[model samples]
Target: GAGVSQSPSNKVTEKGKDVELRCDPISGHTALYWYRQSLGQGLEFLIYFQGNSAPDKSGLPSDRFSAERTGGSVSTLTIQRTQQEDSAVYLCASSFEGLNYEQYFGPGTRLTVT
Candidate 1:
């Protein structure tokens, strides 16, 4: 199967606008994760979904950030009312099982909020 894929490799938006980022995990991989990386910073976990279980969203920075995995394969991360501080790269990863397994990451989407 193919590795994870993300759309719109780059995005530039004004403050207060909304944006959506998409991720398509490898077929049969049941775990998906979203992460954010700011300039010079480490990857920050944003959300995770495993199987049919409840998604772990504790890592979301605020209510304005949300994500959903449809049919357990594709995922979409939405950021509302974007701010300058939100400028960064959004990464998506997936594994066969959980965090214990090796994760395959997609080329991140670089977002610039001004």
Candidate 2:
């Protein structure tokens, strides 16, 4: 199966705008995750979905950030009312299981909010 893939590799938007980032995880993988990385900073876990269970979204930085996984495969991360501090690379990853397993990451979507 193919590795995780993200669309709109780069995005530039004005502050207060909205953006949607998509991710297609490897076929059959049951766990998907979203993360954000600001310049010179470590990856920040955003959200995660595993199997048919409820998604873990406690990592989301604010109420404006949300995500969903459809049919347990493809996922989307939405940032509402984007802020300049939100500028960073949004990364998607997946594994056969949850964080306990080896995870594979996609080429992150770089977002710039000015």
Please name the candidate that would achieve the greatest TM-score relative to the true structure.
Answer: 1
Model 1, position 3, has a per-residue lDDT of 82
Candidate 2 clashes between residue pairs 3 or more apart in a chain or in different chains: none
**Whole-model Cα lDDT of every candidate shown, in order:** 0.91, 0.90
Question: Which RMSD values do the candidates have, in order?
Answer: 1.2, 1.3
Candidate 2, residue 92: CA error in Å?
A: 0.3
Could you estimate the TM-score for every candidate? Answer: 0.94, 0.94
TM-score of 2: 0.94
What lDDT would candidate 1 get against the real structure? Answer: 0.91
Off by over 4 Å in 2: none
> Which candidate has the top score in lDDT?
1
Q: How do the residues 1-114 of candidate 2 rate in per-residue lDDT, one tens digit apiece?
A: 688999899999999999999999988889888899999999998888886454566899999998887888888899999999999999998889855688899999999999
Provide the clash count, candidate 1.
0
